[model samples]
Target: MPDCSRPNRINIDLGPYKQRWVAYCALHQLTPSAAFRQVVAKLTENMATAGDAAAAPPTTRKHRKEIGLTDAELRFVEACAEAEGFSPTRWIIALIQARMGNGAQFGQFELAALGKSNLILLTIARQLRQIAGMQQGLAGGPMPELLPVVAEVRTRIANHTAEVAQAIARNIERWHGK
Candidate 1:
């Protein structure tokens, strides 16, 4: 084969480790370049042990993305996509799909929740799996860095729920004149 070990080429040169890396990339749906870039980025951040990196500052997102479109701008995008034989919505979705990183599958998150809550929970579980995959690509595993953030988010949600429940209870008491 050609000299694939040059940069920007997918060359599996490390025997069993190469095979395992290929398998992992396939499983996680990550392009080797993207995966390698993530690792490089992590290394740039800090070269401490896994425990030390996990305890370091919170891992920030790769980048900030925002979509802003006025009606005229949206119409223009629609017109362009339509001229290219796709609807504006589909064009936007295609762009997003192409830009998205590879996803990972995690365990079944089936909880005995009412109505569509299970669906939301399951979606969360899947997204968390993807996040873990990204984190792994960056810095191995055991994401202690995310623990505090997750806990704070959970606590905030619980407090908000409690406040809403208390408000509803008070309203019910007023309605019943009790």
Candidate 2:
């Protein structure tokens, strides 16, 4: 019998769009794998961009304004950079990038929230698994010899869940207050 695990690569006949893809890949200096990865990255990076061209948000063609910052605001920006262990200028640029929708800040926030909730549930599930493993280990079985390690992982996961929940709650409260 043939191995069923590997994916089959088939040559798809692209009637007209084949040239376009080739040209795009050539222009971007990408190999086949790199081109595919780039296309996927771009689509994943901007979900809105994957929509109909006419329905996409209007692009801002004008140059961005360089507004003067107050000393207090500058200090706050610097403090935030310090706290995050990033350069103040790069942090400001990242903020601008996020505002311009060049980066996935909104998507990241949604994913982080979802991950935090899932992590909490995963922690409890892992704990249960560890308890099961411990029971098996107590029965003189070698399969569950790593019960102590699993328990430690469960403890770390539980702590992480609490921290994530607290942060999420604080964000929600602050958002509602605004």
Candidate 3:
């Protein structure tokens, strides 16, 4: 029992809802205090009637709330997803995860591109290593012929790396509409 003399010792009977509240908290992986904080923030937001929506900073979306979209909006989403070479559902999920800062947000096409780039880099690295080994195995010193080949391979690596970086930047900018 709480001490009634204490000013902050307010209580509310949960009755049958206590179990449900506990389940809700468990489902969301939040402690009671954390859940209550979200509830309080939402309550305050609802009570405030004069706040400008545009002036408010964007909040992290931490819950699943159903949003209604018109046909036009759905089409727009589909078009945007198609432009990025992704399905609408994948695009939406990727967007949400990106907003949450979960990790890299790469579309299917972007991923394939990166994968190809990685494979090329690996092949180039192997060739460079082989050339280095050959140069080292030589009796006297570095071979002039192998030197030009090594230089060319290094240039290829640098150019390919730059291209991959640019592609990643473009994809990120497209994804975030920046």
Candidate 4:
């Protein structure tokens, strides 16, 4: 995610072309704010995720690009962010980042949000076998006591992960500007 240290404010006056583009976006059922976000998402969709923040050096901030939004539009964004426990700035960043898929790489955020939890679920089978081996050590044969609980948790997480992935897929399709 970009350094969203402040709220993204479009304080500059739009040139004529920009004015027309904004109007066209409104004609397409997208608000000016949503259009700006869509444009940004398209621009950055293929960019790689940045280096780890812990390993990155801090630097002076550069001027950020701004867009023009009406007071009502800005207020709506603020309200949505607040409802989601995010500052308006973070919410804007999230909007852009959500649109930027992981491309070919699986970053932490992508893994968590996508079905990479499947990887964790995959391990449960082997883990159950290991637990069964331990039980064999305690007795003389395989013990399946923990299997049911482990399987139940695995199924639940898988179902939840699928639900989240489906929701994200629908959102992307809706916002991808078909």
| Residue 57 alpha-carbon offset, candidate 3, angstroms | 28
Candidate 3 residues lying further than 4 Å off, grouped into runs, are: 1-66, 70-72
Q: Which stretches in model 1 have alpha-carbon errors above 4 Å?
A: 1-139
Q: What lDDT score is found at residue 102 in candidate 4?
A: 25
Worst 10 residues of 3 by lDDT: 46-55
Candidate 2's residue-wise lDDT over 1-178, tens digit each? Answer: 5446756533457789888988988888886667876666676666656666635677778566576889999898888666544577756765666555564222234446667768767776777777776676575555554666666876777787677776666444433333
| TM-scores of the candidates in the order shown | 0.25, 0.36, 0.54, 0.36
lDDT of each: 0.57, 0.64, 0.78, 0.63
Q: Which regions in candidate 4 have their CA more than 4 angstroms from the true location?
A: 1-61, 65-68, 83-85, 94-130, 134-147, 163-167, 170-178
lDDT of 1 by residue, 1-178 (tens): 6775675665547766887777878888997767777777797665455556465677566555578999999998787566544566655554454445212111111112222354545655765776566577675656766776566547655665665555545434422336
TM-score of candidate 2 relative to the true fold: 0.36
Per-residue accuracy of model 3 over 64-152 as CA lDDT, tens digit each: 66778899999999998887778988788888777766654777777787888888888898888889788778999667778777888
Across residues 36-123, which tens digit of lDDT does each residue of candidate 4 receive? 8888778665552553553445556855878788999999888866654567776666666566752222223444555555666666
Model 4 is weakest, by summed lDDT over 10 consecutive residues, at 102-111
Model 2 stretches astray by more than 4 angstroms:
1-49, 52-65, 102-146, 160-178
Ranking by lDDT: 3, 2, 4, 1
Model 1 TM-score is: 0.25
Residue 63's lDDT in candidate 2: 63
